[model samples]
Target chain A: MVFDKKKSPYLFLLPFLIMFFSFWLWPILQSLYWSMLEWDGLRAPTFVGFRNYIKLFSEQDYIIALSNTVSAAIVYIGIMVIVALFLGFMLNSSILPGRAAFRTIIFLPVTVSLPVIALVFFIIFAKNNGVLNNIISTLGFGRSIDWLGDPRINLWSIVSLRIWRASGFYAIFILAGLQSIPEEVIEASIIDGASGWKTIRLIVLPLLRPVIIYVIIASSIWAFQLFEEPWILTRGGPVNSTATIAMHVYRNGFQFFQLGYASASAYVLTAIIVVFALIQLLINKGK
Target chain B: MKKVLTAAAILLLSFGFLSASGAEESKAEGPIELSYWGWGPHVVGVNETISPAFKEMYPDVTVKAEALGPWDLMDKFYVSMVSGKGAPDAAQLVRRVSEKYLISELLYDFTGFMNEYDGQFSEALNRDVLSVDGKYLGIPLDYGPSALFYNKPLAEKLGIDVSTIVTWDDFYELAVKISREYPDLYIMTQYYPAGTWGSNYYRMFMQSAGANIYDAEGKVIRNNQKMVEVLEFLYKLHADVKTLNIPVNDPLMWEESRKNNILFYPRNSYFSGEMEQQVPEMDGVIHTIPWPLWSEDDDPQYTGNWGGVALVVPQKGPHADIAAEFCKFFATNVEALTQHWYTTTGVPSYAPARDNIIKDNTNETFAKGLMEAITVREVGPWYYTDWAQTEKILGDGLDNMFGGKLTPAEAWQWTEDQLIKILGR
Candidate 1:
């Protein structure tokens, strides 16, 4: 059944429009509406304008979750970017042997299931008979510290796992960026008697700025959305020290059924991510 | 064309009549399918055994049990309830998660069905726990009463009289003594504070001591003197006495504790299954006793619950009456509960079944202890609404106190402050 040429485009687009409205756009608007109300997912929502948003900022739990997420972003991104870049820099070098094998090894973690990774790390980080603790004990480290039990250290342990899981994927991206850099430029720099460090600092890094920005943007978003690692490993505990904003939203929404407040917190988290992304854009513009 | 149309219409009418006759036939004699959602092998085993028995009793009804983890079941339950679609006819609901669903009016009230077994349950659950307004919401399936499970061999070697410790203070002294004599073998693992504030241990201890986070009227009472006292007691155990080991539910910790021959592990009846299953070597070596009291002067209500589930029929499901029938069959039938006790490890809440199991297994220390302990099992007001947040607050304070970051007073104060702020009290 053919439509007239002008109407055909609209006809072709109708299914997508219907889906967009029903699934995506409607939920976004509904969640925004929900953010202003007081709802336990079970009962009908009560209108309480701005109260949820106010409570989110005022509550200590929300603040702690936010700060933990920010800390994770800083710690995870810093280690991940530096390590991925170094690996990329090495793997891209003509002098390196078995580059493909190294690349595969680096990217392997990305392929493993996140929950499985969390479980494996949970075993490794176990205070007794754990692979890490055993190794540390053999090296004459005193009694095994309760790595997951101690609130002060558990978040860092979770961060380390996140770094381990993510660094490989980011390395491949950077490797691609490194490969795209012109060979002639590196040779020219060498001919000018520039030191290896100088060549990397000035030429290689400058050329890889866009890729670095991309990594930072993607990773920071991923970092802020952290739930599974901490949830499976710690359940956001040893206290809520390891809890992220995502975990808090999950607790409020699912466990407690305070969906309205959860929606408010979620929007605040989205705002934080957007602001960070915008800052990244500014940095990209400056570069 | 007229002849052909008449023949087609006659054929369609005949088919319709046959379909109508088939429906009538099935109405007289056909199997009724009922869907049940539950978690774990215990539920599966019970359903598997009970289904055949149930079918034998009522040959027309079929019970289909879908075993899933609690979280998975909750996800499906919530989505189905909200959407008014895809709900199973029956499901197991934990007391911890009952309020949210009950408040939504999603559950079919089982009051009438429950009335049939008025005197059957071993202990009558507070009606308010399974009720919203005046309507009973679900049937209590199991009881979770906290108890001290100890290693008999280790206790014997240490010269500790396990039965003599009747109070927390007495238990504390025993812990100190064990820690002093056997530094290698920790007496107990207090992993509660590690999970979250208002952790299971804290909740259980507080409830056992007759102090809950909220009063009957639903006012925040977490900052009371009783809570402060309990927190101080836990802190002293962890920080000063240094008798409490930190396991925090880790598999490695369990392994290490087993290797070190931990003398005591405080847990509910439900956890005994795990202890026995995961570390089968401790079968004859382990013994359980009723939880110690807060003080000798205080009353001897020495138990509090950690986990208990109820059988609830969803309002929007295929067969509510059949589901209720199955629930009654599962909950009150002596044969079913007896089979359940033998096959799996839930302490049946039905009096006849529970009493029979207890009488038959009087020699089993674990069963005896569980029977003695679960009598005080009750659901408090704090079980519902913002309890998770309270748990988080309690968790942080408990962790800080245990980790040497805060004193007991400070921890209590911190938790109180958070609760006051969050609860808007």
Candidate 2:
């Protein structure tokens, strides 16, 4: 029997298309509709137009959440990219001993569950008997620091957790990119009296731009959508210092039962993330 | 074309078989199974003791109790209620948040069934809190009367007399003395960063002062005097006495208790169960006392109610009547209540079952404190539909105050403003 190529391809894609429409597209459209109404999950929804969006913008808690999310994303992406690049270069070097072991150790955190990591970090950051505080005190480094309790340091602690868990994964990607650079090109640069650092800065970095760009955009999205670590560790507290935009959406939708407001905040977050990705793409395109 | 036809036929046959089995199961005349959802030791009690006794009594109705963490249970229940699917036949709902469910008309009206059990449970809980417009939506399972759980050996070692610490002023003085005398010892555990701890303490103190975030008419009280006082007291503990600020339910609290570095935990009746479960080694050494009064001369000495759970049957459940009967049995039956007390160590709100559990209890200090707390004049927070939001706002304000970002007065005002803005009240 003869098969129609076009129809056969579509038939093969049918399952994936069905799932995508049912789970992803349908919810997105439904949430957009819900974003226009003032409904607690239980009651009849009343259409409130853009009032929920207006109120969301004017909300102090939403403002704080937005600011926290943006700042954390900036800091998290910056540190993650730098650390990943350095580790990638080190691992790619032929002279580094036991590179495989270092790679395994670095990538170990990525395999463990996030909640487990957060829980372990919670104990380590405890005020009195925490390992970190105990070590500091043992070294006579003044009083015990409240890593999770202090508003000033709690968000940074969350950022540190993100970096610890994710930097290695991105480093692996950067290492692959580094390996793709031919040895002959590097030798030519060195033979032309270009020092190692200079050869890398002018030559290696330009070729690795695609991988770095991917890392920055992906990590940025993750940073904006951060929830589990903050939710488990600090619960966005000490006066909402560590609360992110995603936490705000969960609190409003599930905890406060304000479905419309939560939906509005969520869409706003989506827009911000889109704009960020676009900006990154445009910057890369210009370069 | 033949392959496609065969695949389609197989899929249709499979679905037909699935539907046939589902229909057969629905039509079969078997014993009814009531699904219940809850959390903590109470759920353990329900699964272990209550279900067995209930099965023995009914002979036709069986219960399947599923346990989850408190917040996880609440989240699952809320999602089920919202989606109008996957809800249990019966679930344990916190009394403080039950008003929201009541207002949403999600609970089965138990007025008809509960009328027969009038005066069986405590009037303060059943009549005043669990009912709305004479319609009963839930049965009181337990009442959380606040108390101070202290380490008796630690108190003796510090030369502190628990009897003299009857007032808040006295408690504060004792806290200061303990801080000065034993640099490593903390008087209590308070978490400044977590809003839950802030709200818990705020609710305890506010109810002790005979006030709440809401007035009698359900309007939020702005710049409440009682709230200011409570915040000031909490601030002093956080700033002056340097109370050990640790997250609630953190393992560190238990570790500190074991080491005698932390002496007092001002918690509710449910905490006795927690202590028994978490630090069982300190059972004989630890004792409970009534919550410290606001002043020595204050009349009646009202204590605050912190946490309690109620058994509620959702309106959408398939077996509402049977579930309500099970709930009633769980709450009121002496045998079931006794077993529940043994498992949970929680003071049941059912008056008739009270004496039975309290009479021969091994933990006499806890039992006595529970009895005193129940008999004393108590004030419970007014849980409105917006109570969760109000609690969060209040908690954030308290967090700011304790973190030194706002003064007590400023925190009170900030909380009031936030509530007004958020609730549109």
Candidate 3:
């Protein structure tokens, strides 16, 4: 008679629901209202309904940030998926010894600090004297390439580092998925005269669908919040080439102290993220 | 079920009560546990800047300063200010949106407090804080008086008469020669995508032409000939004379330039610490000159007048009058001023403080020159500075021009287009 736990799990969820509503839901609702305003954080956010969003359409910097974010996302997700699958295959390979060590090495970047990773990459790709550039120069190359200078290529420099950082983490997830695959099914595939590639393509790849979706969802969410690297490395510049929306939002809020404008931008960015999540959910559902 | 609900309600209410009680306790008199948040070499770890002196003076008002990474600090400040949580009373707000706060009714006005304590500090009070409407929201923290830091060794090595480098063209020639001579050595570190543009160039050129982003009224003025000249001049050095690949994000760029094969770096006031560190073996290897004179003025002078940090009393605090008095005390006290200057490697706002700081200053040869540079600096402190926007014009513009993406005029036009978009005028 007393609140039936089985009949109403919503009752059990009520506390979490309240906490979520108070913090996340309320801020998100507030931000949507702000997106329509003209604010500079410190001052009263004037209600310039839809002007901020209107401006966002034509703004070159925002466009650049948006594109760069897409580029980072593609590179980040692509690396995660590709590396995760490859490492999974390696982990599944019985002939390849030291699976545990390989898994540990691939998974280590996730545990390490990103700034430290960035610092290491910063030294490696430095124009005047990066380890990688030094090696390139030593190989009888004429010029020391400015890795993060060229506007078109600077985004790649960031993406490569991002790939290096994220692939290992995704590999762990893929490895877990590979482990979940029952031995009997794989043995049956092997006896059916399927080669390693065929077995992977038909048996392992098809079965790891849920894990793949999880990896995509998790990484996409992480990719949306690509602030620390862009903040640390180029700061969305050589001229707004690397400027992500998150970094821009951060700048408006903090550096510029145009909180109202920043909040509006934040909400716009949040909406964009929500759209991305929704699209991801739709895709997962279709799958 | 009833018992469980009662327990849950009690816990929630008690936690809320505890939080409110903590806020009350923070405001209480007995050993005031106040926390000041800022960004620098972690304030708590490195107890040099905000010292034990303040703690000693007000033993009851215990202050623990913490450093949040500068950008992160700004983000937290923004969030806290809006949400009304975890904001420090006297947090250092950057001077970017000091305008919006002035025009709009946001910050706690500090005019009444300033008038009351006119005796303690001198006339070095930065009037730049007050908007056109005359509401002083922010106290000047640090001034960026642009100066030309020339490596004496590098200049001597290049065999260029450093004194003859009077104009932007002349500096360019000297820089090119030094760069050509020492192929490995860049003439200077001209960073893009950061404090690269709209700074030394912007101030110097703007002052040179007597035109700025605003003209008395806080209106956006984009098309200034001088502003264009600033971009064009930077484009020349950036295109023809190759500078180092340095992104001016960290303060350490100055240090890197000095250590590497660089001749002159045009920055403001803070390069003294860098020079001191770079050429520690050679006691007097560096000299500070006025920013390389850019324009053809009747009586040419360099501009570096980025007014340094100022003290302010927050709106609501216990003993607000006493807090104002503390600011005045610290601002005036020669000993305190000297400590601030020495510890922060920041310039003293007070002219009197200059004498004490320079007397026993164990910095590089630039110490004497720096004080003189500050004295002679033509400050053009503007309120509404879109630093990111202008840097796009100068930094990214220069880079593209170098890579042959756009011609100088085309780059300028593109920049103008971008600025129009940013400033919306």
The alpha-carbon deviation from the true structure for residue A278 of candidate 1, after best TM-score superposition, in angstroms, is: 2.5
Q: Which numbered prediction scores highest in TM-score against the true structure?
A: 2
Per-prediction DockQ? 0.24, 0.39, 0.37
- Model 2 Cα lDDT, one tens digit per residue, B1-425: 97678556655665566456544123224689999998777777787788989988898888989988877888898888887777899998767666667642788887876788677766767754567877888888887788887888888987888989888888898888888887777788876445444576568777876667776566778768887887788778777684667567766677678787778888777777778788887767767778888977777677878657888988867787789889988888898877776666666888778877656655454323555544455555444446667778877888788778889999889888888777777
Per-model TM-score, in order, reads 0.86, 0.90, 0.84
Prediction 3 global C-alpha lDDT: 0.63
Cα lDDT for residue B18, model 3? 46
> Residue B43 lDDT in model 3?
50
Q: Residue-wise lDDT of candidate 1 within B1-425, one digit each (tens)? A: 87557545655565566456544122223668777888765666656788888888789888889888777788788767765667788888666556656652578877776676777764335342676676778888876667777777777877778889888898888788767866666667666453431276667777677776666566676548887888888777776454434434545445655675577877777666666556666667767787888877765455666657788888656577778778888988887876665544567777788888767765453333555555543432234445555666777777778777888888888888877876775
**Shift of residue A44 alpha carbon in model 2, Å:** 1.0
* Candidate 2, residue A11: how far the Cα is off, in Å: 3.9
lDDT, residue B220, model 1? 76
Worst 10 residues of 1 chain B by lDDT: B20-29
lDDT of 1 by residue, A1-287 (tens): 76788656755665565556656876889899989989876677799999999988887778989999999888999999998898888888789999999889989998999756765786787664668888888999868877776777888998888888889899999999988999999999999999999999999999999999999999999999989888777777766788899998888877677888989999999999999999989978986
- Residue range B1-425, candidate 3, lDDT tens digits: 97578656755775576467646224555655455565543254224434456666766754556767554665676566555555665555444433333533345566655555444333433454433354555545444566777768767766767778667788887777766767777677665534323343444444543446554443556566665666667667776776765555333354355465566777666556544544455446667766656665735354644334444444554444444444555555567666655444566555567667667766533333666655564555443355544544445555556557877667666666666666664
Error of 3 at B285 (Å): 5.6
